[model samples]
Target: MKNYKSYIIGLIALVGALQSCVKDSYLEEVNPNAVSSDNYWSNLTESEENLTSVYGGLLNQYLWNSEVEALRSDLAFPRERTRPLNYGYEWHSQSFTNTISTHYFKSWNALYRVIWRANQVIDGLNGMDETFKSQERWTTQMAEARFMRGLMHFYAHSTYNHGEIIIRDKIPTSSEEFSKPLSTSEEAIEFFRTDLQFAYDNLPNTQTQKTRVSKGTAATVLGKSYLYTEEYDLAMPLLKDVIEGPYGYSLLTGDDVSLLFTHAGDYNAESILEINYTDQHARLIQTTDSWDEEAYTTRWARYTAPTNLGGGGTSYFVPTSWLTYEYSNEPVNPNDSRNYISGTNIAKSVPLRCAQMIAVVNDEESTYYNKTPGYEATTFSGTVFSHFKKLTNHDIVGHEDEVLSTSWASGKNMIVYRLADVYLMLAECLIQKNDIDGALGYINAIRNRWGLMLLGADDGTGTFNDVTYTKETLMDHLMYLERPLEIGLEGYAERANDLRRWGVTKQRFEALAAKEYNVVNYNYTKADGTTGKGSLIQEGPTVNVKTDVNTEFDDAAVNFIESVHAYLPLPTDEYLYNQEVN
Candidate 1:
């Protein structure tokens, strides 16, 4: 119940040496000369070092990982078909399967590690002198720690809440407590909400460094928490404050938005909270030296979309045919700039060949592949694949191999919260509460900014005009079509959870899987003497790439994925360790 501000001030003033002692029984060895709790909080420098260690622990969490491959598996793979990999192996790819047990365990462990470190910091602060607690620095640090703890819990709940009941109570000192019993989904959510509320109350509006946490970030996260809980009314005002308050955030221009994923202007004004990556400091390294290196390079070149110029390969994250068709079919009046900005305008200059390749793949393939053929050179053939184009750093092209190296750092800040996300959430909430007009206004505000035409009528552009609907159904559709396109891979994990909650993934997949589109061959080979025919072939109205693809969300699939598996299980090991304690 102690307020964050007061707690901070108290710890700062009483800055006594805090020892970081480990139990001899718990570890193989101990450092005799290591700073003990007695000296840890005693001096300013030592206290700061302890805090630094806490920050390092925060970064080690699953949510902060660079590659984020687990996210794709946990969120994207089970829900939608962007590509076909292990998806054909129904048991292996299903979220409920034991195949992903390690992923679930790793995620759980990593988050608990973060929480444990935060708890240490919190305890350290608690043990500090009352006089030092009133200081601004101490207050901010404690608040930040609390916020991080909340964030870790938020992710934990999101991952394990499907049906597997898992929970970790606070920070576990002994290995036993680390593996406590799983909390119910509702309980986990409440725990996260509690931490976020503390963070919101204690954190400041701004921070001196961009890397640090602040009030706006806390509020934004809190709003997201509320949105996830389906408490839209509570979320709306908090999100609005983040957008309109002293946060100093604005939507980046299309060009600037593209630059955001590159290392160009990463920590700019538009960022609310970003997992900061630097070329010099904390570089993203390949997990292994040889295979990972090759995989990384191939993926970079083949998966990402080509840069503004034509020299690079296109590895793009192609929008689904359903998404593309929806956009194309929408009303696009000449007067509406929103439609133009939304999808019509070509903000970046891409090669004609690349564009054509993208169209072909989206139209033809039932399951998207990361690598495909494109324009060919004398020595090398272009492979067209889907990549997060926004995150590409063209400046480091020649040293593309070293792009993931610590030295060749690109400054692509991953945005955790943004203004647009909030607006959409508000709209969703309004619609849920039967506030149709209110919802429309919120949606319109976003569209208006993009120069889109009005929603309900057919614009003469051949695309259907926006159609009005009752609040309930309209909200559902908006979340279905609009949200996916708008947020894309940013909140992909969250989207998957929402789909589960709405019980729509199965239906959505069925509808999309049944549709057909045009497919063309982009791989052209020259004949011995003259120009040869390209490998352009139209496969299907609906191409079935695999004969064994699982179309039905069968009981096997359900069993493989627990209802609680929708949320991540608390690391079984943690609860195992703590069984005696409980």
Candidate 2:
């Protein structure tokens, strides 16, 4: 069992206990028995307890619990064959219509919940006794709260609300305070930097509890914030620090790379920050309140797993044909033995990253949901079909056969930030700075992990594998090649952010829309001695955009208005409630 204790139930019970302390006697001028923030925040224990609640807010539906980020990117498509097409179709197709309003509100609301709780903890910590404030525990907790606040603001600005979000620096005491005006992107990033800088300055290089944020986490995020705003000069130092720092971080290699998504990989050496989940008491009971429901587990697996694989998964989102082709497009390292399909003399197949990412047919080397040797059978055939395997526990155990009664909940922790991402980000920064040679090392470091051919004649062989790169070529490789393969579908809207940042969202989508996809079925013998579709390859009349039932092929090519869709609109509730926003 995971040792890190998430105070999910403890947070709920504590809030209930405190609220019970309210004594509103009609005759009293002031209730001495009241449990206000002033009285309750008497020491470090209270601060620590409240901080845990702030962390709990990360598991919200619009946050880590779902793949809203992936749905928005070209990397994933909503499984249109499944029901409730409205879940991701709007964002996936970039419709941004009245149908998507609730999604916008939920996203805005969830992120702010984290920001508000973080602000509450910060305010409480600030108002505590002076001696307590002087203690090391107080400083550390303050940094943690600040880190969360800045991080959430960054998410709201860059990911969801797109810089039209209000910066909630403190707990609001009145309606006016709560309804503050939106900050410009510059104002928001500046506000976020102060908090993140404090966090980077004060946080330990490493934490006793793997779940807690550390110095490396703060640095990487702070650098990322700068990178997002195009402050490449400002971003370079911080990212470089993470690359060379004594944070004890390194990339997981070989078969161990498969462990990155499993329960056993939680808080591994590569991970900088992770949202921890557990199945010790996984429950199926759903509540109207998002925070109160299944605090120790996530529905990410059930939502992303392949439905046809007999896993009881909803198959809400699956890897796009574009993404699969990108993996296949990667140049195979002929020297490496792992590059080939098992039991096949064919020298090159999809690399290790592709095998780890999605289940493919006739792959005797990889496993899918206890189906050893490969995904030999699935109901999804005749059309090109592949489901996400990265975030789901489809390799370790079948979703239906979990120890818990519920099939929806999973204990695998979500890795929000890891060393590979930092390496890629650093490479991007170096490329932007015109240090093309400087950037190749960071990029090649990732390639070296899979024993793939290095770029730009860096390898001693000097053959260059017929691949030579200039500054422009290297940057192209960084954006389209390195970023997608390594950190593609992993984080919060990572691929979407990259597409937007590179000014290629519309182009990328249209390109994907134009491509044709195909399905190939391998021959296999049944127990009854019947031969299945043997070496049958079917060309798709289907294009990528129409893969999702809700999306029109023309929608991606025509309806994607880059100016409006690139940055999502602020929630309608913001205009409805905030006097200053309108």
Candidate 3:
């Protein structure tokens, strides 16, 4: 696994330079003094440099991907009502107004920014000086650009922007071109798959910089597209191409599974694609907010860490009771090392965090924790129980003021695609084909590694016994039960997408709604191995406890969860300001 640290440094500079050039009109103005696009992207080397900006666009997308995609889904519950498009809170407007909407606008804008840059790179590539670089290099760069372009469209089409989105395959130089009519969903999905296939066939098996697109990266996207579309046969081989490819992808085992998230694992063998964020600050809280010194860092950690820990770091997201319960590993065994504090092999208490975090931070008998004995889950009442260690970095207790310790210090290379995710998708593809043994092989491999009882095997935990499954039951198990447990909270909206694909999005969320107003006391393990109590439901009277989403869960959730309303309504600006949509 290579970090390609130098490449990322150069990327930051290029992204900075590119972003500084504001567009006053649809056509970018060319400064006769500066390097213009006409003269700059005239060769393979230059075109490749331009491709870095596309990757920069991807880095920006990652800034808001989890909040916008995952939080609104069943995977996470937002503790605050800041964003219009967030789950588990009330909203000011049913129609997404500009004031309250941030995640939806930024996600849509950033991905399209990638598409915009990709189109520039692709158009420029046509005129690249072949003699400056190898034919293979030029083609590979083109493939990478196409993959980025298609990936942006695929997600934007499926995840947000429910209605038609303007498909920009080429750089738009005129105002007329920028405001074209929207394309249908069928057109978008097929367009997305076509671009991905071209890249899958052309990209190298491995690249010097693991962050760059490769054969495995392209295959995973193509396969995922098919999987979401329910094209079982088409999905299997493409997914298999990534599964058994020469890229050396393997699930992170033992401590490696936990380390899979730290900066040390940025380009590890398991990674297919990841948005690279350096120690540099990533974005301002908004265009109007004072410029943060830590431009390359994300505020995710600030939102996740509990208030008692240090900086009032505990408002944005709280682990749902559903997520907390899933880790209990109840049915298969009394404990499955994955939970927060009460497991045998892995003592588990809190609901959120990577498995190893529990092993390190709060272990059984309190040997490890008793020695440190700092602020523990004791402070977490109804508000914050599962302080998600995925981003919290529990290994280091203590922080400075509110602004996270020295900015960007929360620099953990977030995982976008990894080995376990690939394996589960492969299992899904195989199960659809009635390949039960083969599907179970992949699934059991993951289960066995995590100290979980195999499908039929039962340890001493009364929660376990033996059960058999037919095709439908297995599909149900994989989509609802297996995937949420394995891939939940890592990032993105896969859990929501999983439910949607299984045709259970509305039903599952509606079930969750029943518990919206209900309150629960925090029941956690103590340092001395005794069960201790914490705070009770603490939402003030201002909160509409019955509504489970940012806006009234009933209507806003319907727009977000329903299949036809899969895309969020276009930003308020789309119709009010953009001449095209109006």
Instruction: Estimate the Cα RMSD of every predicted model relative to the unseen true structure.
Output: 8.4, 4.9, 5.7
Candidate 3 lDDT over 1-582, as tens digits, reads: 334453455454353222111233624564344333576775666777778767766555343456445555665555532232233242211234334556555656666777877777787777666674468888898899999988888876766555367677876555565566667878888788889989988989888776788888889888888988889889888888887879778877644655555556667767777766544332232221212322344555555565554323222565554554455433333455553343345544332222433221222322111233323433544434344545544443344122344422444456677778888998988888888778877887777556565674344454334666667877777876678777765535676566666777667665654543323333444566665444223222324333223222444345443534334666655554456667
Q: How do the candidates rank by TM-score, highest first? A: 2, 3, 1
| lDDT value, candidate 2, whole model | 0.67
Clashes of each: 88, 0, 26
Regions more than 4 Å wrong, model 2: 8-35, 80-86, 98-101, 160-162, 283-294, 309-315, 340-349, 377-380, 401-403, 458-464, 520-553
| Candidate lDDT (C-alpha), each | 0.48, 0.67, 0.58
Better of 1 and 2 by TM-score: 2
Query: Candidate 3, overall lDDT?
Result: 0.58
Per-model TM-score versus the true fold = 0.71, 0.87, 0.81
Best by the lDDT measure: 2
Candidate 1 per-residue C-alpha lDDT over 1-582 given as tens digits, one digit per residue, 9 for 90 to 100: 111232133233321221112232453334464334544676444555555544444332234322233222222222123233343223223444434445445555556656665665676676688776878777777787778777877866665545334444344444444334556667877777787887788888777667667788888888887877788789988878887888777765433443344456566766676555333322323232211211122232222333322223211233333443444343334454322224556321222212322332222211112232222211111222232333333334433334554212233345555666777777887887898877777676555544444465455663334576787667766767667655554542656666666666555555544655432233333323233322222224424332212332332234433354444444444443445323
Per-residue lDDT of model 2, residues 474-509, tens digit only: 888887778887876676677777888889888877
